[model samples]
Target: MGKVTGFMEYARLEEGYEPVPKRLKNWKEFVIGLSAEDSQKQAARCMDCGTPFCNNGCPVNNIIPDFNDLVYRQDWQQAIAVLHSTNNFPEFTGRVCPAPCEAACTLNVNDDAVGIKSIEHAIIDRAWLEGWVQPQPAAVKTGKKVAVVGSGPAGLAAAQQLARVGHAVTVFEKNSRIGGLLRYGIPDFKMEKSHIDRRIDQMKAEGVEFRINTLVGDLPKDGPAAKVTNDATTTITPAQLQAEFDAVLLTGGAESPRDLPVPGRELEGVHFAMEFLPQQNKVVAGDKLKDQLRAEGKHVVVIGGGDTGSDCVGTSNRHGAASVTQFELMPQPPEVENRPMTWPYWPVKLRTSSSHEEGCERQFAIATKSFNAGTGKDKGRIKSLTTVKLEWKGGKFTEVPGSEQEWKADLVLLAMGFVAPIASVLDAFGVDKDARGNAKASTDLSGGYATNVPKVFAAGDMRRGQSLVVWAIREGRQAARAVDEFLMGASDLPR
Candidate 1:
């Protein structure tokens, strides 16, 4: 617990941000992090609430109040120790996580919640600055080998945990680089890739092997019908991997996007969110992209009101789009949640992203009817979007009469979210899948992350479907413990 009256004495302090006008010019993180003193004061706001809902609210069950108390006591190293005990990468979560912990804070009933996220950000950064963060090499080698297929947060967490417990861990990534979505899907402006690079270095120092450009699946005999990014000349077959590794953990993420199957879906201008996001991230990493997906001087319409949609808006703004508009099929939510009605659970409320602040017209209660492809020579390209006004009636969406309208647009980005993990990958491994197409695995203490297939396991988005990075890390850690127990008939690893 923190100071007895700290909650009453200290008001929540928020971290500052770079001006929109200045930040829009470059693809760099513009967050003005809180000063050391202010961050400590924010940490002091943590109260002696009998039940810490912040722990339950956090996906990884981070010891928020403990770290907050540590920080308030100016024990930066101890604060980070408390943080790292639960979260493998507090830096990533602190930067991007929506901080449901704050929502579940007791102080949030009438006052601002403890600035847990910012305190986390401050602790990890201080730990790094003070060189407290280092590779923890295993004391003894178990001679067990594990292959974690994915370099996202989940896979990374699992690999690190296994390696620290004396298992030889090798991470397989299909992309040319590691850090799956962190290296590709997320823009550098939101979080610098150096965070990932340094972590990779630390993992390497801890004796974990990283294999990039190694796709774990059958090769398309005739090559892809359309160009997709990956460097695997012949995809590493799952059979080969299973035979090579003692235990195989599939954490490849949900890559299959949910497509809008309306007319003109194949138009050249309409692209999935992943296709647009990774390209910019690559460009930011100094890769020369051929015919980059630029929103330059084009009327941009983004479908989906989620984080991916917001990302599209920010990228489009940087691309200098003529105008950016977002469409959401659902009705607009209230500005603030009624905390009394939904205390511990995450509530439905309007969320405006940093991208939204840059510039964008957001339309709720609207549905895309169809794409309007131009005539003649431009028949394969999108020219506009025809949308229909929608209304909620009897808890269902209904189209408004005579509300159909067309808006001219040169580009349309679909951020409609992912449906499931790629079926081909799961099929290759002969792993059973859930109804949602995610890898089916029981999370029981005995079987843990075991799949129907012997010696095979699943975690992260591949097992849980689309989810947060923090959840992925938690699943990865839990799966690692399960795998260790399976191999050794017991495990000292944290659950």
Candidate 2:
């Protein structure tokens, strides 16, 4: 509401990116954030609608209008304060969130939505540059210990909240590093590791302890689950955590990738996206990986049309793949959404990520039938795959007759998305699981996030199945409040 006619006077300004050819050579963030002036103009586009749907549209229910107004008025400090009041890491969400808030913007019904994500990016980046982000240590110690398993957005959010409320918090990560999916799942080209590092430093200064390479529970010894990244040198059982900590929060994300049970799936060149992605991230972090999976000089086929699949395409291009092709089981969505019908809600529309723009041949309404192995010297490695076109009829996919085809491919990356959290970990804690295999937990205001087991709570993908990072952070913050109430009989922390 800073300027009533601002929306009519200003057009949305998008963030910029580096040239594709030049950015392909390095694994670093390429997005050129909106400048102060551009951000102000974009923020000025926020209409003074009677109701701001963007607040509820955001996973954390951020005060969107206030931040937009602050940014429009050039109040950088206040803008970040409003941003951090709801989000623990605007840097992460600002960089990677799909920006459902923008989709729900009042202006979006008839015009381009305000550039909320870009404004957030500018505010946080500026705040960091101005030394506005600092440690907020508690003045009094609660003397209660809390254990947070997994260092992803959810776990980090919960740990920071609990630590700020004067509780002793220790975060356990199975990987060698602190960030869970942020460090391994996301490519550096989208968001660099330095953001996670600085947050870890701030959390450390705020009296939170991080135990990297520590597994809270056992993982399956073999199978697809076993292939998940784990560099744990120490394993602590659920019983030990229950005895040692006042509360235990499970934020370990959904790590079980949905497998494609097709012929020749055992081919050496076929791998899960996680298997290939984490290795590249580790390499980028200066870790030497033995027999690293590379797409260089190979015909790469990435199965799945989600963000993970797009990421695969980008990484493959960075690896100098001869070609990259992405497949989608469903038909392609419309390029533009019908705002009249889907206003104030996330609409189904075609989304082409920066990775897709780099270079990728996308196939929709297709299904893979089998992987084929190579001959002689290339035996045991994937060579090609058979696919079939599908038609959507009567609410299900039916393969089209006489549409079978084989595509040449030297490597196949399965990026169909995660199914659920590692079952072994949930079982170890004696936590009940939903039909979908996610930890069974309710979000009820009374005893929300509480698992069946005593003193154990579950949040994020572990409880809700695979979802956006912003949702994970929301669950983490809410779970922290739930745990706080359980410990002190009440809580002042925001839900």
TM-score of each: 0.97, 0.99
Kindly list the per-residue Cα lDDT of model 2 for residues 187-259, writing each as its tens digit.
9999999999999999999999999999988999888888999999999999999999999999998999999
Which candidate achieves the best lDDT against the true structure?
2
- Candidate 1 deviant stretches above 4 angstroms: 219-228
Residue 442 miss distance in model 2 (angstroms): 0.7
Give, for candidate 2, the lowest lDDT window spanning 10 residues.
216-225
**Compared with the true structure, what per-residue lDDT tens digits does model 1 show for residues 1-495?**
657888888888888889999999999999877888998788778888889999999989998888888888898988888888889999999898889899899898888888888888888889999999999999999999999998999999999999999999999998888898878877888899999999999999999999988888743343221223566644688888888889999998777777888988878899888888999998888888899889999999999999889999999999899999999989999999898898878889999998999999999999998998898998889999899999989989899999999998799998888888877788888999999989999899999899999999999999999888889999999999999998899999888
lDDT of 2: 0.96
- Model 1 TM-score is 0.97
Question: How many clashing pairs does model 1 include?
Answer: 0
